[model samples]
Target: MSATEYARAVAFGHAFARRQAVRTVDVPGGFAVLDDEFDQVHDLNRLIGTGPVTAGELIAAADTVFGTAGLAYRQLTMDGPTGTELVAGLTDAGYRADRELLMAYHGGELPEGVPVSVVEPATLLDPAERAWRAEAPGLADGTYRQLARQRLRRPAELTRRLAVLGADGTPRAWCELYLSPDDRVAQIEDLLTLPAYRGHGYGSALVAAGVAQARTAGCDLTFLRVEADDGPVGLYRRLGFEPLGEARQFHRAAGGT
Candidate 1:
């Protein structure tokens, strides 16, 4: 795919993430309280709103539940580089910037003849689950277990779908697709490739699978964020994903009193 097309696909991925985040909110605690609906490529963080003080307070509260309890976490969204205070707040706490991504999309001919199958967690393989677990370092063990529980119990609240391509057996790589409440978009929740499987077009194939799922769900767009400094920016660039915006994160670890 050309750079333009790649960028567009990535943007679609981001939109999907945003919409899924908005839809999957559980209210009172889960997603609704955080109000991550507006998060975009330029502003990846999802924690913002009402008053500045309220926003900070909300972050602190989230720290207790999402952070400490490990049931969830926060992703703050800013238009560009964060302010000194924000940086200090995050650093003093424990949180630091994670994925700085170039967001882009337009939509057209995807990589030719990429095979895709969208399967739910129930239909997926344990190896695929392990691959995603290995990729998300920030995800706590409790949270990971809870995800499995939610999928088994409250399947609606958790949409765990995967995209696979390449050789029929053993598979190549897979991507997770999250379906939100509104059903407007599908979040490419997470993408994973076994260490040995990297660089073999598996990632792009996963991206294609996500797009197909999102469109099938009646969603118009999809989305995700990448580290601005990550070398793969070129890969995303070549794929058509462009820089749409930026976000900053702050965290305080247990050491902070």
Candidate 2:
């Protein structure tokens, strides 16, 4: 697929991730998901799309939704002209921009001998919750449980979750793959290796399993997004993934309730 199409596919996958949230709304050029229960930027508030909406209009729309939700911060994905103007407008409005690389991997053979397994999204919840809590004990509260529950309800054919298990059958690493309906593109998302399992090839194994599943499902291209400073570029490259472009996220800190 061409670069622009690839980027859009990745964006679609992200929007699809929050399908269970009740507050997503369509705006002038795109859509937004607004919530007050979760601290995650994407979960609490997010604007998606890259159409030709004015900065003023975009800000006004975001303010309406975020204000009503009593949320001060909103994250936006930068894409087309509308994205550019929103970034400038949001900056002037006291928001900060964070950039990340969007990467893609065309289908190919995965490495051998790396054990990976595909599990139901529901099956991932218990172990994932435990792992997450182990890493961030402070966040092991009701809100986190609620978010985890929401994530377990996968959006129909559009998404799939894969995992690599430890000897005891606990998830060591996992990732989600989203396939476009036409089967032309897929996106690998939320790839994570538990802190205790990092560097044991579980991450690589999970990724390979995701790609293989996408290919078997008839997708020719796959994509993912990674933080600019998280430092996994080399790992993805070694797995035959390459940079397509960057997606910028703009965040506005929470304000008055």
Candidate 3:
């Protein structure tokens, strides 16, 4: 795909993630999402879209909204125009910036290997909830397990949650396949394997499963995002995901709240 088309596809995935938030509010040039249930900035808080707004104005708007919501940290997703202005603005405001690559899968045959089973979000709920409760506390503060329960209960129609189970039927790894409402594009999200099972083929199996499902659902394109420094970028590339573009995020930790 052309650069323009790739960018648009990534934008669609961003919009999808934003819409799934627990709450959203309009800001100056975009929206602020609140999802305190999950620990990640992409899940918990987001500032999207800046359009033609000045950097100062955008920061002021973020301060107002996040301050009112009592949230200390937030991630601002930067596009071409807004990114240039916000990098300077955020630097002056004492925030840090991180870059992540948005990747896309060109249509073709999927690699074959370990089989992945498609499961209802609810089927994995019990173990997933348990895993979150056991794992989230050490990872971050706040009610992660509670939020995870809420997330599992609120699966969107466009989203397909799949998993690989162990001998005892415990979930070993899982991923989500999200098809755009227009059905022209899809995204493979949250492809994760438990730490104990990292070296196994579960992650690759999950990706293959999601990609196959996306094609079956009539989506011609698929996409995902990875941190620039993350090791999984190599795995994704081996699975046919190519780097299309990059987005930067500016964040301030929650001390202000």
Best by TM-score: 3
C-alpha RMSD between model 2 and the true structure: 3.1
Cα lDDT of candidate 1 equals 0.50
Range of the 10 consecutive residues with the lowest summed lDDT in candidate 1: 34-43
- Of 1 and 2, the candidate ahead on lDDT is 2
Q: Model 3 over residues 218-255: C-alpha lDDT tens digits? A: 87777887897854888788888888877777777766
> What's the best-to-worst order under TM-score?
3, 2, 1
TM-score of 3: 0.84
TM-score of each candidate structure, all chains considered together = 0.60, 0.83, 0.84
Each model's backbone clash number: 43, 0, 1
19-112 in candidate 2: lDDT tens per residue?
6455678888778876555645354467765577766776787787777776666667765322566678778887777777877885455576
Q: Candidates' lDDT values, in order?
A: 0.50, 0.71, 0.72
Model 2's alpha-carbon lDDT is 0.71
List the candidate 2 regions with Cα displacement exceeding 4 Å. 7-11, 14-23, 34-41, 80-86, 107-109, 134-137
